[model samples]
Target: MFTPVTIETCITFHGHVCGGISLGYVLANYAMDKLGAQRGDDLYARMECQNCLVDGVQCVTGCTTGKRNLEIIPGGPMALTLVRRDTGKGVRAVISVDMPHGLSKEEAKNHILSLDPAAICTFEEATLELPN
Candidate 1:
């Protein structure tokens, strides 16, 4: 379970709390739950954007850039796919929530946290993609 304390740790590691991280946190936890993933497991994450979301996933799942298990591919919509390298099973999450433009960062974060992760994003089964 990625609890509020985990979000606090992610915020400290990320330098601030924002909507992106909160969404990422929710999505990451949802995906992890779907895949039965635990922190420090042989997990691989493919992120579809370059932003705060990456930090949330990294902190929550213990998959890091240095570990070469987190890949950030820019130019796509905000999405994340997490796979267990051992079984090639994974889940893809694409954000579906829409926040108004005028909300403050805290408001945005809280708005994201208040909803169910499935309400904030859509999830589907996926297979790991790796280049030879």
Candidate 2:
């Protein structure tokens, strides 16, 4: 079985697990599965915000800023577009639910992790023009 990277891995990279990391972990896996992508594939990630979620995306997709494959554009929303460089095709996952308020950090993380990708995000097909 191809085990998807666990949330614990993202938590280790992110220094802590929170709602954003949980959401990112779930959505990144969903996007990769939908696109038939594996970690370290020739993929590009365009992120819409800078937050803990970025770390989760980085951890799961292996598309890091240092590798110049992940770009943060600061669009003021929690969203990500993961594109396959070879095909210019991708999936965009936009946050559709607000992070639950008044919950402990661990509680929030667990709650977000439990949600289906469709429950926390709305996904759309995307086409990207990536550099060679």
Best by TM-score: 2
Model 1, stretches more than 4 Å misplaced? 1-5
Give the TM-scores of the predictions, in the order they appear: 0.90, 0.91
Candidate 2 lands at a TM-score of 0.91
The lowest-lDDT stretch of 10 consecutive residues in candidate 2 is 1-10
lDDT of 1 by residue, 1-132 (tens): 434337778788889878878877887888888888888677899999888888888888777899888899987777889998888888998887664367887888888888878777888999877533
TM-score of model 1 relative to the true fold? 0.90
What lDDT score goes with residue 121 in model 2?
A: 77
lDDT of 2 by residue, 16-103 (tens): 8688888788778877877789986889999998988888899888899999999998857888899999878899888788878999
Which whole-number lDDT from 0 to 100 does residue 75 have in model 2?
Answer: 52
